[model samples]
Target: MLRVTLEQWRMFKAVVEYGGFNQAAKKVHKSQSSIHTAVHKIEQGLGVKLFTVQGRKTQLTEAGEMMLRRANFLLEEAAKVEAVGQTLGEGIESQLRIAVDEIFPQHLLYKVLEQTSNQYPLLRIELMESVLTGGSELLQNTDVDIAISPVVLSDGFSEELCHIEFVAVASPDHALHRYERDLTLEDLKSHRQIVVRDSAIARKKDDGWLGAHQRWTVSHMTTSIDMITKGLGFAWLPIPAIQVLLDTGRLKPLPLLQQSQRKAQLHLIFKDGDRLGPAARAFIGELRYQCMQLEEVM
Candidate 1:
């Protein structure tokens, strides 16, 4: 048997959050006396003083601080339980929103989407192709149910999806390839470097090396690849995306002394695993399965 009721804990939290019984009562639309009584009952049940009044200001006691932390977790779990019940009763979600970084392999992404569509034909999916921190920003803002990004959010859960290899490359006719010897950082600094812009509106930043004397920033990776292939600039391109270009001699690897290749790990991020609907879970499962297949073949 529980000594303190969930309602009592909620009222206690309300008083603490709103700063006083009167304020909590106004916020919760309850009588001040009732709010005070609920909090009192909590303290009595726990055998601890939860708050202290000093000059009309209510401050949490040492025990109150500890209790508040536990109370918060308890309430959050309770809310999640109720939410799960509602979701179960409501059946599958009508729409799913996902933010995927452009760096993820297109074939695998398409395959995953195709499999998910086959499972939920009537489900609507809003896929947002993001770059760099763009997917993370969307997940943080709760604009997307899931995100595939190189960046991991501090408040969200993430699992390593796959590693993407980026190789420094340029067109065969580009001036950089004219160097007979292994290139140094100084040798590449004089040339124009093409880069994709970070898609995040707030807290935007650049990733990887940006040491070139002249820089050309584009919004999409395809644009950067196009510019590079046209000898407009040189940039590090993902191996999977430019594998055909590399094989056909359209793009040649830069002969750097070291650090010519870089690897970035992409992660699948979500706020809560338990909160995901069947559709979202199916998408994630398909993605993992496809990645495993790729690994086995490689």
Candidate 2:
């Protein structure tokens, strides 16, 4: 028999999370005395102090910190189980939100969505496009149910969907391409570089070379490609994104001495795959099928 109960743990967690017993009581719809009783029971059962007073504020003791960590984990698992049960009873979700990396091939994304929409005419789909850490940010903030990105999120379930190759290229008339021999980092550094700004609201990241003497930071990869195509600057563009331009001689690959192209492995991620709703699962299936269609061409 255990002296500690899940309810006691929840109350204790609520108290710490909400900042005080009074706030916790209001959030949990319990009396302040009940919150106090729960905390007191936990402390007594463990034979240790879980809190200490620091001036007018309540602070967690060392023991409290340890217990709180475990409490949070338990609460998270409980929430997952409850959510799964609810979704199971509900059949299919009315709406599903997904975030994808802006670097992902647009046509493929649309193809998957088109098929998925046809399958579930009643399901509403909300799609968000982000760059670098942007997709992960939306996921961490719980703003979306699923994220497809190259940046692997810390705790999300992930499956590698495909790899995208970014090729360093410049307009044929650009000064960087005028070089007779293979381009060196030092030689390329003298020319202008078009960079795409990471779309993450928080923790924005800089991708590729950031050492150009003249750098033009743009909001999207399309802008970067536009700049490079017009001979305004040079940039590394996803092959699929600029394949037409490359074939039309609007953009030419930089004759770099080494590593002119970089590969980014994109992944499909979600908070909890096992607990995902039917609509989300259906979307994922179509997404994978579309990815396979592209892989065949590659």
Candidate 3:
């Protein structure tokens, strides 16, 4: 059995990631000699040359590539273990950056943040309200740890959470609901309409899915809601987002497209396949759990 120190494996993984010991040492806050020595010890223990050094630059051997794969797995598992302990312990100061679309309300999210802050007193929460499309791109670039977006998931990312449904709504005085029967796309087109500020909405119209022209556009759902409250136009909104307004009779369900209203999806997106940190993973868990609870009621 080969026994490799965690530090040695870390040095090796750093070298693989950075492509050189000198750069790896700088990143790990260690001297280049120290990193070289660690890798040397690992190679000695395994009885294989891990790297092919032509000069100051080095390339990974077959053994190096194999070890790199295992080393990264071990490092990730160890990080999870460490993070689990840190999560239980109090007073570990950390910062978490999260991006969310405006579909979710600040008051509700603030409650979640308050609970997290109370439990993890030292954790600082930084929130940014990014539109769905822009937020997805930010998540792909790893600019934000996690993002709540409405895009369908694809390869190279994880859809950690999604449970909300989109519903068609309008103000009580809107013409769509006055007929007391389901409204057709033809009826919707007869009136000027407010639409979500997304290029995708227009594309849907052009494709005949919406079958109407939009009279106005707004950046956020709240803007749409506000506009509808003042009788601007009807639009689709997340059920949970507009539930309060609906309950208060500020908004009325058109139910015109009830038969065709497909549930829209909201996804919690992450970068690099599965390299999520503890804070990011925990937040994803909470968001999923809460959304699941909401789904039960719907």
Candidate 4:
């Protein structure tokens, strides 16, 4: 038997959160007296003082502070329970909108999508290839159900998927490689550098070193790689994306004293993990499995 009800705890939290009975009443669409009565009932039922009144101010007592923490967990768990019920009531989602960063390997992405589609043939998918903050922005705007990005959303849930290695590379005959010694940052600045533009419209940003005096900013990674292969410029590219070129001797890694290679961690971010439908869950499972397989081989 519980001394207090869930509604009483909710009212108690509302009072603490909104700072006063009157404010909480307005926020919760209840009368001020009802809000006061609810908190009073909670304090009486628990046999503890939950708030103290100073000159024109209501503050929580030490006991209230601890109760607030427990109350938060209680409410969150209750919400999750309701979300699970709602998910069960609805069938598998008909469509899934996913935003994937361009930096991720295309082969792995295609493999996961293929597997997911095979399982749910009726499911429609909208795949957006984003860059840098673009994926996070789509998530924040509720434009996508999931985002695979190096930039994690502060307000959303995320799990690390994999690490991508980027190596600085250029054509074998490029001016930087002609030095015949470990190139310094100063030596590379004189030549053209290929950079991919950030796709985010609102808050665009640069990801790596932009110290080169001359730069050619393109919209796609393929364009940057193509430019590098033609000896138009040098750029740092993901190893997975350029592995074939490296193996074929068409692209050669730059001999830099430091920072010749860097790693970026990609994460799978969800709009609401608890409320995901069966199709979305299946897609996430397949994505994780594929990433695991890649890790084992590396």
Top candidate (lDDT) = 1
lDDT of each: 0.91, 0.87, 0.71, 0.91
- Residue-by-residue lDDT tens digits, candidate 4, 1-298: 9888888899999988898888999999999999889889888988989999998788999999999999899988888767556655667777899999998999999999998889876678999999899999998998999999989888869999999999999998888888999998888899999999988889998988889999999999999999999999999999999999999999999999989999999999986788787888999999999999888887
User: Mind giving the per-residue lDDT tens digits that candidate 2 earns over 1-298?
Assistant: 9888889999999889899988999999999999999999999998989999787688999999999998899888888777656655778776889998878999998888888778766667898888898898899899999999888788869899998998999999998877788988888888898998888987989878877899999887878888888899888889999989999998999999887999998989888888787778888998898888877888
Off by over 4 Å in 1: 1-90
Give TM per candidate. 0.69, 0.68, 0.59, 0.69
RMSD of each: 16.1, 15.2, 15.9, 17.0
Q: How good is model 2 by TM-score? A: 0.68
Clashes (backbone N, CA, C under 3 Å), per candidate, total 0, 0, 0, 0
Worst 10 residues of 4 by lDDT: 81-90
Model 2 has an lDDT value of 0.87
Clashes of 4: 0
Return the lDDT, model 1, position 7.
94
Measured on C-alpha atoms, candidate 3 has an lDDT of 0.71
Provide the lowest-lDDT 10-residue window in model 2. Answer: 80-89
Better of 2 and 4 by lDDT: 4
* Candidate 1, run of 10 with poorest lDDT: 81-90
- Candidate 3 similarity to native, TM-score: 0.59
| 2 against 4, candidate with superior TM-score | 4
